[model samples]
Target chain A: MDFFHVLVVLLESTIRVSVPLVFAALAGLFTERAGVFDIGLEGKMLGAAFAAGAAAAVTQSVWIGLIAAILISVALSLVHGYASITQRGNQIVSGVAINFIVAGSTVILGEAWFRQGGRTPALAEGARFQTISFPDADMIREVPLLGPIYADLLSGHFLLTYLAFAMVPISWWILYRTRFGLRLRAVGENPGAVDTAGISVIWLRYRAVICCGILCGFAGAYLSLAMTAGFVKGMTAGKGYIALAALIFAKWRPKNVMFACLLFGFLDALAIRLQGTPLPLIGQVPVQFMQALPYILTVILLAGFIGKAIPPKAGGVPYVKER
Target chain B: MSTPYAKLPGWVEYGLIPLINLAVAFLVAGLVVLLVGENPLEAAYHLINGAFGRGEYIGFTLYYATTFIFTGLAVAVAFHAGLFNIGGEGQAYVGGIGVALACLWLDQTMPWYVVFPLAILGSVFFGALWAFLPGWLQAKRGSHIVITTIMFNFIASSLMVYLLTRVLKPLGSMAPQTRTFAEGGQLPKLDWLLSIFGLDVGTAPFNISFLLALVAAFGVWALIWRTRLGYEMRTMGHSPSAARYAGIRESRITVITMMISGGLAGMMALNPIMGEQFRMQLDFVQGAGFVGIAVALMGRSHPGGIIPAAILFGVLYQGGAEIAFEMPSISRDMIVIIQGLVILFAGALENMFRPAIARAFAMRGQRAAAVVQTRGA
Candidate 1:
């Protein structure tokens, strides 16, 4: 392949790998911006992936699988809301508990239903997501830079990838421009002020968490239905945590979240690409070090060795109104 | 505004509540078992029998408990200072490196007693150093402890993989583990100690490290309750601003608390490395560090409470393995579900039933008050 082709392939893979991270990071943004710390994003995504894969395999419909995934994700989010908000339990502990519960439940239920080593049976062609190509791609291919960009880089991606990128600007507008978004942001920073303005902090927080669940649902669905044929054990891996790190690295802004996810995705794709290739100075860089780069970078970012990251003021604290 | 359950006697608060929570968790686990087409009671019986039916089983259970106790205390100590140290897995992993180094350098020349103390010191030093950075960041840089510690776990695993494969793996061996320690470097099993009491443990992995765990627990109890440093740490946890006003150095306490916590977690290497395997390997820490979180939460961050909590989990681990072996339907992953259920009930939904119980007690109190009023009238 030519250098241009290589660049196009690398960029395409980066976008493909980053789709889930983008969804998950945006999911985290909604919750954290509304004053709830969501360490359980990993668990919710895992649950949705399993539900989506199992449903699609059975129903032979990707739409049905997407709906099943969202429903399960929302259900898990409600459990977290009830525990952390209504019960006044520790939010971190609740998130951690959710992670454990969902991680175990998915495997157990998957094993019971499928009897396939905690994995859903692979979906057939009609049941899985098909790539969407831009119209008249063959005719457009001779048009130089725009042609290659359209036909090679942008075309033929799973529908979820476009949706994930679209959600970035949509999320930014909602978080920055909309009235509900204003209240969500205010509640995260100072719930007492929002309550004084007659807004119900609990309701606002719940709405944000539900939004988070929906985004995580899409993220999980994308993983199982579009990126892969079916759900595997721990398929989300540490992406949820990585998305969380990206969320913090973005300083909890919607646009920055996209950039952060793309950066991580690029790192991931580069790690895979460079696995066997020898470099100039370092010779052949070990794959483990490359895989660990994101986490190490996240730690350094968090430690303020680079830029400062300030969390929402009321993030971990459950608001209790005075009588 | 005081709830009746909150006004319960001390024993009920500390003992009965946890017991009830454990019962609820097990009930949920049983429901899950039933859903999987197995008899819950039969599975429970097998679990209990496998965990404690024979002296050998008991020994293995205690051996598992020893590691849990160390990790649990590690979590509890940091928790008392209002810090969440989730990097125990990483700390323990690096601690293994320390043990390996000590054994590698001293095993051939030095006696076991001399080598063991050096290894213990090495483990403690490395573990403490691993935790110190995160604690320092949380104290000075305002970084979240949970995020940094979790990040460290991944780093620790990757670092170990790199070290084992590239640096530490013995030449000409394909296995990803170090050379076995010399006979002098290995810890003696506790068989002789048990035999003195006319009890046989049947060549279990139980070793003198279990005694070390007990001693560490007692030491933690004393540190948290009987010392001024512990007092300062508790004050800092309860109210950071108040602690600052009271002349406690927040950063100092944070660092010290994490160091002690990491040291405790590091000592877990003694059981798995020196006592059992006699060689360092990758992923040796397994999920024990995460399980320590559940243990500390269940134990309410007290060394006294952690012991029993650790033992309970030991039963789950040993018993769960037994059940997996006997039952074809229930896989090893089911044990994880059970563990998750316990964590959910004990940690997250700890007070779900508290208000109802309090209301029930309040009604009884009101009725007695009305009877007294009527009798007097």
Candidate 2:
């Protein structure tokens, strides 16, 4: 009812919506950093969402759903890897093909399996990721601002939400601190250099895509198992693209990716909130304009209207060893 | 991977290669059909029979091909210039706005003949405008065309939703679409043309747009194979560095090529909006732009090849609809799977079979050379 509460509520929704973007953008970070352009993130996520939803519905276990999602997503990532990394093919074209494949197959398979018009059955509570409540939330409720912020805004989120946030620092540490991170970034920038230094560019890129697939699996599982009750056809919508935009907007940095996703998520929440509300002076604000803002802003950012977004130096080019 | 292989004969290079790729794609799709518990042979029979069993069915297939031709040419033109114009979908969607505006303004007073030219211009203008930013950004600002064009697609979708629901929707109508066009706005169907072959089209929306698409394909062929601009585009496509060395303006060529591609993509709306739907609707493009990529890839980015490739997709689409009716388990998405496979094999893994083909040719050539040496001895 109060201003702070309304703000907290909006922020809470923002966090919820940004979870998938966070996971997806981080997934993209690994692949792109390792010199593999993955426009198929959307397809991978959608495939995993269907897999997770179907598995969860069948087994009534969220953990099984997560595992299934991972397996399916990883399979897709391998296809992309084989095409771009192994075949020396066009990365963009391969990614596009993957996207179209998953987009259609998920629906076809879902229909054949469930007969619910390309949707998995609605999942029971046990099949979905459960929300975890902070300890002593009832006792702490009387403490006014801090209590509401901690208990209401921060606590009572799906387990994946916490994991998604935790992934930020973990990803940052892996990207900047670890040995694998160094080789990964090095491969993206100069695969030839990495090759010269006795590192297998092909193997490193494969591992990065594997990492990408694992993270995308989490993102997809979170969508069907945590955010929604079941898998719906085309449910990821353009989140994968939005995640790509967020990655570019963030300049491919892990910390910036989180902020960019949260910002986009906030905009999405605002659009939903302002759907029918008339604003002062401007009168009715079309929700479409708000919805389009992220894409439009991304285009602008891509055009270097703001700061330039430079991808990895060797990104999108398939590496070939000199014979 | 960059090493050049033996040069292939013309037939093998163009015809046999694409055919093999198509066959492989279908084989994979057939396997998927088998996985779905339907006999693959039965599905294929139904698919073929559905596509060509009746004159009306052929009309429907060609009608679908009309849209593909325009989009395919769009992609082919861009391909000739080494630019991947993924904004075709967005361009086509926005292009409908031009056609709608022209129809809404002049359909009451003008004849279809008068409005048609103006609509073409308007569609091309709007579609080119949608692609121009991405093109210009790629040219001058070092932005990736793929990413920018993709972003434009989302923007166009959102923009159309707003325009249809808020601005274009007829008063009190629940649907998000414009008012139906008047007779002056509608394209005349090729009923008489079909009757010449003693085949009745039977409710098929095949119209003048099919002819227009054919003309556009011819135009693309001439432009790509004959004209000076086409030469520049092909040169740039093959080697940008060489093009730059040869004094071709890289930025100008990129922008112009994208505009031309966008214009061609935009013209695809004429088939659906004027020939079929008779009005602008949200999502009217309906993946045609994306299909253009497959068509271009399958056709090897030649207008001559694109026509047949476009018609093949037309078969898949029309026949897939029939399969959906005949076998409820095998949905239209099966056709989409075929499409994806075609793109994967024809576009991304295009050279998957090339090495083997090249080796076969190399061995045959070596044998011929040995025979010549033996004859000389």
Candidate 3:
């Protein structure tokens, strides 16, 4: 393929791989920014993915499934919020429990309800996300040096992919510009201060967690309905954890988190491409290595770089009402 | 029923705590099964029976408990140092591989006297290696053990999967395990003891691993309670700054504790390789390291406490599998639900028990009031 074709493939694939991560990372941002450590993103995404796929298959419209998935995920996130925020339970354990709950529950429910063990019924084409066709600006292709790169790197994706990129700026603007953002950050950094200021720390955390839930919902929707158009077992496949790492690697900055997600996505894309290419000694180079590529990069990026990323001081501490 | 439980004595509270934990554990398992439309009570009944009903099943449970002791102890020691060593999974695998390698390399030429010690030591050596990196990172760079250990798990898993498929692939076969250990490398099984109990020996794979696990637990208890190093580890766990202020090298302790934890857990692999797998085979360490976290947590990270906790875990494991077949109603995932519950209740022990104890004392007052009223009537 020509350079232009390669660029286009890279562009589309990057969106396909990174959208879920971007959404998840952004979800993580809302929680972390509000001072709630959300290791439950993996569980939230898995739960949402199953719910969305099952809903889509039954409803025959991915849109309705997406909405229901968001509602369900938000509800589940509330469980985490209640346990951590109200009960003042251990956030890490609660998060771990949520993950376990979703992982085990999804498969059990799937097997019984659909009679398909660990998977949902496949979606109809109508239930699947369709690509949006944009008119080729061939004139741009004929223009100066930057034209081909632009065409190759910027066209043809599901609407959500475009929205994934859009959410970062939206998150950034909301976090830095709005009243809600200020309250959220304040609650995270100092619940006592937020409380003394007459704002309910509980409400602020709940709001942040709910926002996180919606993004995670969309991330799950993207994996099952948008990217592949089916729900396989564990299809989210630790993307939520990567998103958590991305959030940390970005050090609570939305744009940087987006960049981190894209970097991991790039390595993922690179590994997938290398699969078809011939290499010496180890023929085909076991797909397991490629499958593990993003996680390995996540590990390195997190261990190496996140050493410098500072979390909100009160991040994992549950806020309790004490006079 | 008016809060069913009221105030209680301190010892009663302590004894009833495990009961509450057991109840909660089954409830969690049952609830999960119920979600799939299975009867919770029936599922649990089968699970309970399956885990402890037979000599063979009990043997399997003991077999599991033996390894769990290692991983549990590994996690417990690290917990003492305030380290979350998720790398137990990785360390155990490497250690298992070490045993496999030693057995494979020395199987034909070496006698049992030399080969067995070398193989076990080899496992410990690799286990330490597995933990060293994360320990080093935490000590030197102040990296969170939780995150770094998680990273190592992924790396170890990837490496192991590759080894099974490529480098460690068995001869003349596509089987995912190494060739069987030589007779010299195998641990001696006490089949005669099972026959004494009127049980078929082969049914219960239980062997000498239990003794070693017991010795290790006592060793851990002594290490934690009796020694200056133990005091330092506890101090470090409670307050790293305080330990440092006391002239203790906090970083060195962190590394040493993790190394010891990982090495002991590595020793647990000897049970399966020398006793059961015979072949250093595929993915045998199924979540033992992770489950070790549950065991340690439930045991409250106490050495004596861990044995009972490990046995409880083993019973549930064996029982959960039996439930899968015998009951056919309970889903096999009952084990995870039970595990999750054990962790939950163990974590909540103080809060749960404190209230119950206070309420019990209040009940005594109510009984006295009732007697006075009856006498007046």
Pick the TM-score winner: 2
Model 1 residue runs over 4 Å out of place are A138-147, B1-5, B193-199, B368-377
> In candidate 3, which residue ranges exceed 4 Å CA deviation?
A1-4, A136-153, A276-307, A320-323, B1-14, B111-113, B170-173, B193-196, B327-330, B348-377
Cα lDDT of model 2 by residue, A1-323, tens digit? 49788788889999999999999999999999999999999999999999999999999999999999999999999999998998888888888898888888888889988999999999998899889999997779668789888888888999999999999999999989999999999999999999999999999999999999999999999999999999999999999999999999999999999999999999999899888999899999899999999999998998899999999999999998888
How high is the TM-score of chain A in model 3?
0.89
- Each candidate's DockQ: 0.65, 0.79, 0.38
lDDT of 2 by residue, B228-331 (tens): 99999999999999999999999999999999999999999888998999989889998999999999999999988999999999999999999999999989
**Cα deviation of A9 in candidate 1 (Å)?**
1.9
Question: Which of the numbered candidates is closest to the native, going by highest lDDT?
Answer: 2
Most DockQ-accurate candidate: 2
Ten residues in a row with the worst lDDT in model 2 chain A? A1-10
lDDT of 1 by residue, B179-247 (tens): 998975688788876677676888678888888899999999999999999999999988899899999
* CAPRI quality of model 1: medium
Better of 1 and 2 by lDDT: 2
lDDT of 1 at B371: 100
Error of 2 at A86 (Å): 0.8
